[model samples]
Target: MRRLMICSFLLVLAATANAAQPIRLGLNYPSTGNYKSEGLELRRGALLAIETLNRQGGVLGRPLELISRNTAAREEKARANIEKFAAEGATMAFGGATSEEAIAAGQRARELGLLFFPTLGYANAITGHDGQRYLFRETNSAWMSARVLGEYLSWHLPNRRYHYVSLDDNWGHSMEQALREATRSRDRARHGFSRISARGARHEEYLAALKKAASSDADVLVIVLLGQDLVQTMRLAHDLKLDQRMQIIVPNLTGSIVEQAGPQVMEHVIGTAAWTWRVPALVKSEQGQAFVDAYIAQHQRYPDSTAASAYAIVQQWAAAANRTGSLHSEKIIKALEDHRYSLLKDEQYWRSFDHQNVQSIYAVRVRSRSEIMQDRFKQDYFNIIHRMDGEAAAPNLDEWQEERGDELSLR
Candidate 1:
């Protein structure tokens, strides 16, 4: 009887050991900072992807686990999260939507030799940094987005002069430089219109500066602020009645910004981003519709561009992991560069040269409460006019270098 019991115990132990899984993933982003709303959305979307992947079957026949860390909107916290992720045996790190955070996370990925997949922050440096492989941006950079926006402006409203309202920071300056270069040759280009500092909580000062712009001949107002700043500035603009006169333009600002600014302020507000699930092509696809449905069911609301963008990136990451057949960072990085499969909802190619996941940017307009009441706002918050191809939008090394040069000189 004792020998039989011992044999049974040994069999149970061996079975348990054989069934254990190995690969782990880490997600680093702000869950309680300036962009907490967006950051949380990113986490939720990524978590959804992780759950879905695990449900089907994890990578390389092992159940995958995810450890998420919050940046808390602090650089030290962001760095700490990176170290923790590495120390915790994470082979790859997923992060970003803000340029500063993306670069900081990428730097850590470089030092630790972990693959970092950036979702939101579109700083140009990720791809440029002398061909660094540690960082890979799943979405187009602010550099590419700005260039596309500029070209759209030139093509759609050729005769109109352009004006820029940029925050005094790396993000603002890089985006501004992209626009400047895009519109460099135009004689009517209204360059250097207004420079605002993004270093405050309350935005009365920004309101006053914008009020002055309202008085100017600048018909096209390009705002480069997101989240609270985007909401507050739009609120002040509406209070000051700037929307009735000028065409307001902002890039990569999501629908959550619209919701936060409230229906009154966000009405007639125009913005651009990679892809909103609200778009028709996205809504019709299986993955796109499923993502939207799941997000709405879980969060009880429509997801903004920030949420959609992060979700798209998470899906891309999972697909790459599954295809690579290994959780090793180097293998995953190479798989990302290879980019074997297409995201069910995406409509563009992932360029191998710079690891820029190329997709068309969508331009959107906010609907009024009146419109929503009339049931006219059920459609996507943004209307899609065209899809810009990657080849058409990507700049050569020389152009990228020139843009960076202009940026350094500005500082």
Candidate 2:
């Protein structure tokens, strides 16, 4: 009997030891779909963060593991993935290529009591009306991007006619609305607008959108589509000679998108980014530069804003977890809220009211094909025409409250 008791105690100790293993960091993102390339970048950057953190002995003396589920950029898939992550013992979860995915996944995460940090969701509603205690957005909102881009438009291209070809999704609508408000072109009739499905859009649907925009006689064409869809549509736009007739603006631009669509296609396109690889040197951030170096060493390419966001998500979460020395979601959320951080860029912080990461945003114009090809990797993508501070661009307290529609004292 004594011998049997000793064996049971040893077994229980072994089980406890197994339970003390590394914390699982869940990544629910699209692995297949229009945003597959973006999803790959999220995983790549997160892996690099995990490697660096493990090398440094990890957070709170525990190693970290990345567990991801493919969302295919679908809302239902994202919600289901979050539930799976929670059931699989994920301490926290983060990943979303689109604002729709982020918003849906974040809501589900809240229901499951998991802390979620979105890697690349840009709609204001992610941290606005749809936001909750469980969600923390890492990217700037469409309003913020619109604010910076609008300033340049106001000065350079006042009174220009505009046409908007946006995706029929949360992000697309948010960006289109924000840009319209920014440029003071609220009349959809005066500024022609067209929208295609975010996923599974037919070839003719894209061609039809461009043909309509071309016939509208607009001086500026704002293209809010993304990923493979953007690449396909840009080629169609070129075929329709829309690129030559209308100046193009693509919000939330990334180097990956530019790289996928050759420099000739993306040439002269204007956009905004939270962090381009060149931003590190532009901002004189050594840590950011180191991350760039490490990323290049492994991937042989410049890290785009999406990748930077994924990296920042991992590092920031680990820091918060370490600070609290507990894996409880509430404690970590409180630790991250209103915390100032400087990583791949200059000073940035999580806003207390909405949990949006506030930082500088840039107005970037794609370099000409000739200028881009002159680079070593031919990845010279943007010339920063202007920069705007986060504080100046993000929604003020009144605006946030109006959007949130709640009466709660500042947390």
| Predicted candidate 1 versus true structure: per-residue lDDT over 1-411, tens digit per residue | 999999999999987674575567777777775677778777887777777777777665666677888886555676678889899987778865466777787778779988777766665666654335677676767667767676777777666555676766667776776666665623434543666765564576677768777777766777777667677777888777878877788766676676677766767666566667665355367677777787778877666666665666666666676787656667766677646444545465555556667666655566666774454344345555545666567676566555455442111
Q: What C-alpha lDDT values do all the predictions have?
A: 0.67, 0.88
Model 1 global lDDT (CA atoms, 0 to 1): 0.67
TM-score of each: 0.86, 0.94
Instruction: Locate the minimum summed-lDDT window of 10 residues in model 1.
Output: 402-411
How would you encode candidate 2's per-residue C-alpha lDDT over 99-126 as one tens digit per residue?
A: 8888888888888889889877888888
Output the worst ten-in-a-row residue range by lDDT, candidate 2: 402-411
RMSD of each: 4.5, 2.6
- Candidate 2's C-alpha runs over 4 A off are 1-20, 406-411
